[model samples]
Target: MSTTEVLHHHHKHCDELFADAEAAGLHGDWAASAASFARFRDELLAHFATEEQVLFPAFEAATGMTGGPTQMMRFEHAQMRELIEQMEAALDQRGREAFAGAAETLLMLMQQHNMKEENILYPMCNRTLADTVDVAAGLRQRLEEACPVSA
Candidate 1:
């Protein structure tokens, strides 16, 4: 599969986990909600690491464009990480409103982030680094290592 395919699959996986977490929380199942959210957060961080440590650096080296989309993505990753922390705190306190608000914001941000990466950044990486790097394989391997085949 291409970089787009691999990363896109990961995105959908994270999205499903996010939905599961939200549903559990809405139903007042704090334990299930926390478990699902933890999985979602871990998978998301691993995805970011795969992009920042592996794919983005490779793309930057190949194209010599360090301050482009990858930089923007890194910034967004930081924002999402902060939101994840907030969600964790909310979960710990059993703050339903806080968790819902943070989750809503995260859902929006993730939608935009995934859209940009899927449509623009991944395609650009595919075009720019296709000839030189097996980025998709590296991404697949790292993701599999970071997050095994669990749900």
Candidate 2:
């Protein structure tokens, strides 16, 4: 499969985990909710790591657009990281409202961020780097190492 297709699939995985965490929290099961949230966070971080470390660099090297779209994506990634840190604090305290509030914000941010990546940047990556040898290799390596086969 293509690189964009792989990333799209990963997005769906993350979304599922996010929904699981949300459900667990709303169910009032504290331990299960924490575990679910941790799972979601792990997948989310892996997704970001692979995108930032592998995909973005490949796209930038291929397209020579380092200061453009990839820059914006990196900025958004940093913002998401901050929200994640806040979520960590909320989770630590078992503060349901705080966690839920931060999660809502993160979900909104993720939706917008993912739209741009899926519709705009990913297509660009597919078109620009399809012939390159390392695109798929890099994706597979990160997928194997950073993300789980199933979650």
Candidate 3:
């Protein structure tokens, strides 16, 4: 499969995780919320690593645009990671206010990040990196292996 197709599939799972976390938060279920958030964080971290390590480099090579899309994505990933840590800390402290604040920030960051990937980065990679069949296949295989059907 192509990189964009693989990312699209992963995005669905990401959306589900986000929805589950949001539902848990809405219900005031701290344990469930924390679990969901942790799952989301793990999945996203892997996803980001895959992009940073493989997809972005391949895209930059193909398009000859160094420090473009990949740089923006890396920055966004860092922001999200920090927010995830804050959320986890809040959960550890059992502080509702902190949790709520972190959750809100996470939600916004996730939504925007997903949009940027879906609307811009993924399509660009698909078009520009179409010739890198091995790269795309490797990414697809890694993503599939990392995130099982049950996940």
Candidate 4:
């Protein structure tokens, strides 16, 4: 599969997990909420690491552009991580309003982030990485390792 295809699949997987966590918490299922949020947090962090540590660096090397879209993506990722931390804390406290509010904010941020990645970065990665064999494969392998196929 292409880089875009694989990363897009991961996006869907993460999104499903996000929906599960948000729904569980919003519906007052405290136990399910906590468990699902934990899973979602773990998967989200793994996804972020896959992009920041592997995909972004590889794309930078391939294109020789260090401070382009990838930089912006890294910034957004840090923002998302902070929100996730807050959400996790809220879940711990069983603060329904807090968790839901954070989830709403995260949902918006994720929508924008995923759009930029799927429409721009993923295509660029597909094109740029196509110049060399195994780079895309390596990225896919790294992602799969970071987040298992539990989806």
Candidate 5:
């Protein structure tokens, strides 16, 4: 599959995770909410690692452009991670208001981050990367290994 296609699949998974988190929160199931958020956080962190380690470097080498799309993505990843940490902390404390606020922040950040990656970075990688197949395959493998069971 193409890199774009792979990212699209991951995006769908992200959507499902978000929906599940929302539902868990609405039902006042703090345990489920915490689990769902943790899963979402871990999956996203792994996803970002795959992009940074495997795909971004390949694209950078191919395009001979440093600190372009990859830098922006890295910054976004950090923001997302911070939000996840806040959410996780709130969950740990069983603070519904705090969790809700964190989740709201996460939802906005995640949606925008996914849009940036899907609309900009993935397409740029698809166009520039010479070893697209290898990069996509490696990402698929990493994703599969990182998330064996869907949450």
Candidate 6:
């Protein structure tokens, strides 16, 4: 798979977990909601780590563009991380409204972030880093480690 495809798949997987958590929260199942939200947060953070540690470095090295799209993405990742921390606190407090509010903001930010990455950043990475670095492999390995399949 290409870099864009791998990351896009991960985005969809995280979206599913986010939806599950939101549904559980709506239904007043705090335990289930917490579990699902934890999974979503873990997976999303892992994705960010992979991009920052592997893909971004490779792209920056290849294109010599450190303070461009990768920088913006890093900033957004920090925002998401902060929001995730807030969501975790909300969950701990069992504050459904607070959690939902944070989730709503997170969802909006994530949608915009994902679009920018998929459309602009990933394509740039695919063009610049595809031959030099196995970004898709790195992404898949990191994501699999983040959410290993059971069987």
Candidate 1 local lDDT, 1-151, one digit each (tens):
6655778888999999999998887777899998899888888888888888888988999889998899999999999999999989989999999999999999999999999999999999888777466556666676677668662
Prediction 1 global C-alpha lDDT:
0.86
Q: Tens digit of lDDT per residue, candidate 4, span 1-151?
A: 7765766887788899999999999999999988888878877787787778777887899889999999999999999999999898998898999999999999999989999998988899988877444444645565566557653
Of candidates 2 and 1, the better by lDDT:
1
TM-score of each: 0.90, 0.88, 0.81, 0.87, 0.86, 0.91
Q: Give the best candidate by TM-score.
A: 6
For every model shown, the clashing-pair count is: 0, 0, 0, 0, 0, 0
RMSD values, in order shown? 2.1, 2.4, 2.9, 2.7, 2.3, 1.8
Give residue 101's error in model 4 in angstroms. 0.5
lDDT of candidate 5 over 1-151, digit per residue (tens): 5655666687779778878876686667988887887677766776777778888788878878877778888898899888888878877887788878888888888898888888888888877763454655666667677777851
Query: Which pairs clash inside model 1?
Result: none
Error of 2 at 32 (Å): 0.6
Worst 10 residues of 5 by lDDT: 130-139
Tens-digit per-residue lDDT, 1-151, candidate 3: 6557876777679778878876776577988987897777767776777787888888888888887878998899899889878877877777778878887888888888888988988888888877574554655555566666743
Off-target runs (Cα >4 Å) in candidate 5 are: 130-133, 144-151
lDDT of all the models against the reference?
0.86, 0.80, 0.77, 0.83, 0.77, 0.86
Clashes (candidate 5): 0
Residue-by-residue lDDT tens digits, candidate 6, 1-151: 6755777888999999999987887677989998898788878988898889888998999889999999999999999999899888988888889889888999999999999998899888888766677666776677677778720
Model 1 off-target regions past 4 Å? 140-151
